[model samples]
Target: MPALRNIRMLTRYTAWANERLFSALGELPAGEPLAARATGSGNMVRTLNHAYVVDRIWQAHLQGQPHGFTSRNTEDTPTLDALRIDQARIDAWYIEYADALTAEGHDEVVVFQFVDGGAGAMTRGDMLLHVVNHKTFHRGYVADMIYQVPARPPSMDLPVFLRDTVPRLT
Candidate 1:
């Protein structure tokens, strides 16, 4: 069950880090996130929408349903406030799902199709890990976009999440 504990901690960390990023995003000048940027996803809001869309896709995979997403990001990005709300809700769902997973459940295999129309299979735990790790990677892109605004992004390091939000899993 130690793996289960670690999974729960990771899911919690993912949520904590995302919340910090969203908090920093709130300080951006109006329309700044939507401004053109020379980076991944082209802008802050679109980058975030990419993360959100991916999360939703994985959630649908975990639930054995269709995600209805044809791409990694939507054609239109939501406002920061709206994306924040959606992210919080999905983050909470992952946390609760991770908490409820038993060791056997964590190891269960999930068969899914990638957005590229490729076949894929991963353990439940691996999928969850992907969800967290993938978000962290894109958040790095968002952090870079934040700097384009000549502003500081919030520190969402795992150690910070551990010390300030959830303790390390023993």
Candidate 2:
């Protein structure tokens, strides 16, 4: 029960952070330095694109739709506006899915093929946690990329999300 509660909190916090990041991304001028290759392997735009693609892949899995990403090396970057729109839509889905979930839902196991075409199954809870953790990891990379840019990067931390958006909860 505590784990479920924790997951619920994390899911909420992730939604909050996603909104903030997407909003900040919208403010970025086009053609601005997206990422610092010296600091990380992928540029800011590329890392964000990766996150977006992964989100879509997992979302497709969750929705029982056909997934779009087949390889990790594939390059996919829609315009910033397009990515921002999709991010907002997916974040909303995550929030709604988290809210509507019951304990029984978390226990249900879903089978799916990985991006690499490997077959696997995971509990709804594990998959949900994976989505949150996956976003957090890549968001950190995006934040790092933003730091290398001329514009100030938004605070994407969970604590920051709590303090800034859900102050009443704490």
- Taking all chains together, each candidate's TM-score versus the true structure is 0.95, 0.83
Q: Which regions of candidate 1 are displaced past 4 Å?
A: 167-170
Residue 117 of model 1, lDDT score:
94
Candidate number achieving the greatest TM-score relative to the actual structure:
1
Which stretches of model 2 miss by more than 4 angstroms? Answer: 33-41, 72-76, 167-170
Listed per model in order, the count of residue pairs whose N, CA or C atoms clash below 3 Å is: 0, 1
lDDT of 2 by residue, 30-113 (tens): 665353465443566566667767777877777778886676534555666777777778877877887777898878888888
Q: Which ten residues in a row are the worst by lDDT in model 1?
A: 161-170
lDDT of 1 by residue, 7-55 (tens): 8999999999999899888888888888999987888888888999999
Candidate 1, residue 161: lDDT:
78
lDDT of model 2, residue 30? 67
**Model 2 TM-score relative to the real fold:** 0.83
Instruction: Indicate the worst ten consecutive residues by lDDT in candidate 2.
Output: 32-41
| Model 1 CA lDDT for position 52 | 91
